[model samples]
Target: MSVPQPDSDEVVEQCENCAVKTPHNVSIKLITESNKEENTAFSREPYRITECSQCGAKTRQRMNDA
Candidate 1:
């Protein structure tokens, strides 16, 4: 469930390993859970996964609906 982001949309985020702001490849994933009950509804949570282009360190961030 990896969502692709265009190069123009790339963001500068601090890398935990590098300890500095750097360009990162960002992807989005939708997490969902459902119950066995017929009428039960499922919830979808979107998260952003960022990987540092330089060090390849990855981080996950939960996204909030605006």
Candidate 2:
């Protein structure tokens, strides 16, 4: 398996629980491919998820181009 993108480690926006901008763990996963293989270019985008350090809330964040 390939390693997650470097920037995926960054903390996403503010936390929903405590409303604090804290560092959180991040996980990345590739999206599943659809039957329409020809249109799979954009569908391959990975999900960048973040967990709130203060209250343990999880949120999905958009990834920036590397």
Candidate 3:
């Protein structure tokens, strides 16, 4: 099953481990490294989020760039 979106800014996705919908603060940050050969401007950072409060399920999300 797909995760549910309750509103903007925060995601109310369902946690399979907890068997409930948990609120998560979502954000996207660019990945960078020192002394690296890869490009700094176009690196993809995983859309990250906190664990579910009820069952402590680790969660991650994907974001789209505008």
Best by lDDT: 1
Please give, for residues 1-66, the per-residue lDDT of candidate 1 as tens digits: 222343676787767888777778898987664455563345667888898877789887779767
Determine which window of 10 residues in candidate 3 has minimal summed lDDT: 26-35
Clashing residue pairs in candidate 3, if any?
none
Candidates by lDDT, descending order:
1, 2, 3
What are the runs in model 1 whose C-alpha is more than 4 Å off?
A: 1-7, 33-41, 64-66
Top-scoring candidate (TM-score): 1
Candidate 2: misplaced stretches above 4 Å? Answer: 1-13, 33-44, 62-66
Model 2: per-residue lDDT, tens digit, 1-66?
222232456654556776555667878877644668687776676778777655678877556557
TM-score of 2: 0.48
Candidates 1 and 3, the one with greater lDDT: 1
Which ranges in model 3 have alpha carbons more than 4 Å from their true place? 1-13, 23-36
TM-score per candidate: 0.63, 0.48, 0.46
The root-mean-square deviation over C-alpha atoms between each candidate and the true structure, in angstroms, is: 7.4, 9.4, 6.3
